[model samples]
Target: IVIGSGDLAAGIADQLRAHPDIGYDVVGIVPETPDPEEGAVSLGEVEDLPRLVREHRVSDILFVGAGHPDRVLGTLLVKLADAPVTIRVLTDLESITLSQGVAEEFLNLPMLRFERRNLVHLRPWLKRVADFLAAAALLVVTFPVQAVLIVAGLLARPALAWEERHDYRGYPHRIPLFHDPGTGWRGALFRALPPLRYLPSLWPILTGALSFVGPYPEEPDENRAMEDWNLILTRLKPGVLDVTSIADHPWVPFRDPAGLNMYYLQHWSIGLDLQIVLKESLRVWDKEEGESRHG
Candidate 1:
């Protein structure tokens, strides 16, 4: 639907009608003054844009007519803020250059495009959504085992206390380590079940405190390999699993040397996370097979 007033409105409508190959079918016009002589049927008034869009099932709306002066365009845009339609508003080239807008030249005129919220860029957001879904699934799979361990750990408080750490953006967070204090054979036993030990981390990932990939959170006062590298790494949400953690012995004191952690951060993506997980899984499978052969 085109929203405009006067002969200029007729000219814009004529241009749109002649250019059917441009991939738009102008159903009608929404004129400020009801015109019986107008070629396109009047849809409605400018104030009724949202309702008219819904009633006419409008997928494209343009503000090219003189009735839509730039001063009132902002208010009109706000009215259709949530409308599921592509909005094109005629604006000066300088305005498009100064502000973030999708502009295109048509008929020697600049038109700025506004799209629905759902169609925005999906790069980093894609990873965040994936992390949430993956963490939720992990919780569903590990909940039963975690419940039993929680009961036992409660019986033995000395198993390990919650460790405090700093996550992305320097936000302080606490995580379960399930660290056995090396006081008894029971400690050794719990340490042997590595998967059970880190199962608690899925809850944090689901809560947005962590991710399935990225640097592990460091202790509050732990020394960093390079202050700059450590500062840069904190930009990402801390994860329970990282290549450094996966490659090292499960029982060894975990350390995120700057070089390796930086590499993971530099090339970070969903694909890198999946590759690390696959590599670790294969390592465990190989270890188990070797043990079985020896036994």
Candidate 2:
């Protein structure tokens, strides 16, 4: 079964029809929008997928479509979860292609074998425990610095700034930081020390709103048009420190932010999380040391 009425689906249908020796049938196309290609068997709308699947006895499903790809793919996956069918998805991201398992090219068309694996589901308890303990310890150790920064921020700018940022599931939460009120040297002091600005974020980590290591948070507006693979990363809790930002590898500089986050999600383990935390701690120490020498 093919899901989509776009040119891609039409082209695939044409190819399969032309080469019957390939030993597979084109089956039918399920169009999300109206008006599938002329004379194509329309398998009702996307909402009727379950009925169509049962009626057609679909052994395999080929998904090809555009527009809000994440939502489209997610919806299809949920519908076919228990349907005993081999799933293949066409996507532009090579990371997704590799992560989904065995990737293959058919007639120069790249497709990923869709097998869902939930990283969080693997060891949720262990991850939560690590997050809680690490966040608490860091907060306790940074108390003195936080105190100094609070005073410095007040002197520079009487009002602190709280900005709303979206978490992994697109839930909005406020994060507190120092605002530069243009008080010259005092404002510069607040800006120079990142520890001061990020101290309040620890509260979110403690409260389970954020994680110690995961994909970094981006503004909701900025991520509105993110691709399906990138959108999947948002399902993970936002972290204060991302592996991509502190991995200390030469290849780290060349990787796209979304690709790096996806890599973390795909290869996530408690041990990997510990490594990220250790690397981040060293990075912070180096930054503070440099600041002290300059100050």
Candidate 3:
């Protein structure tokens, strides 16, 4: 069942056509707009939902784009939670995704999560601890290579420019600060490397503006999109590496990995942090053609 004849609805249909294992029978497209483009089977506007539901036999409904998902979904939950056909929201909420229904049998989650107040307080401290550790470790592991890169950067006389990559999008990628202006690119490369990426982040750790492994601190303009990853970072530090970032994209568990600076918030933990780091190092960093397995 597909909703909204917009790109999201079309995109989901595309993905479903690509992955048959998804086990969904996508028969119709529902668009609020009067005229849907070519090749689309429009089920009419979302406001006439009862007719749409009846005509499409949409027992297990998925809201593709109903505006405020939280509010709109709440209404659907009240009306349809008791329906025998299981409903699911799309996973890739970036634009549109097939919302998978939470299995009823597994609804009882056992993990205890961090409270909002405690999570807020823990954020600053978690990064500081992670920063010190990451810096010290990277200094040891990459010292010789870093020295060569530093010397090459000094000799290269590379051009350094500070440009606003995206003004409307608040994620400002500034010219990375460097003592020797020529070495900015090298610095950028070094920072992109694992563990070393956290070195520059240490400064922020000192200032208390970030945590070691929390969600990527929202850029000033990112509050709109922050809702997507907020749950993942609620109790975790936004670290040098995101918890979800792994190599070969191999099987990153829904849980937090161990040792990459996680808090007790949101059923996340240090163990989960470490697992992510290990996956990053062994599977992600090890080879180019790695496949990530997700649960």
RMSD of every prediction: 20.7, 14.8, 10.5
Candidate 3's C-alpha runs over 4 A off are: 2-22, 28-42, 45-59, 63-122, 158-295
Off by over 4 Å in 1: 1-122, 158-160, 163-173, 179-192, 216-235, 243-267, 278-295
- Candidate 1, backbone clash total: 0
lDDT of 2 by residue, 1-295 (tens): 7776655576566656566776668777877566645335676777777777788788877776654356556676798788887766655443543444667687896555567665322244567778888779988998887787678766655646776655655466667755656446645665454455666778788888877676655545653677655665655566666657533343231144554566666666778888887777667767866876887
Candidate 2 off by > 4 Å = 1-122, 152-159, 169-171, 182-186, 216-235, 241-261, 270-295
As a TM-score, model 3 comes out at: 0.41
Summarize candidate 1's per-residue lDDT along 223-262 as a digit string, tens digits: 5454554565665676555556433332211133543454
| Highest-scoring model, lDDT | 2
Clashes of each: 0, 0, 35
- In terms of lDDT, the poorest run of 10 residues in model 2 is 246-255
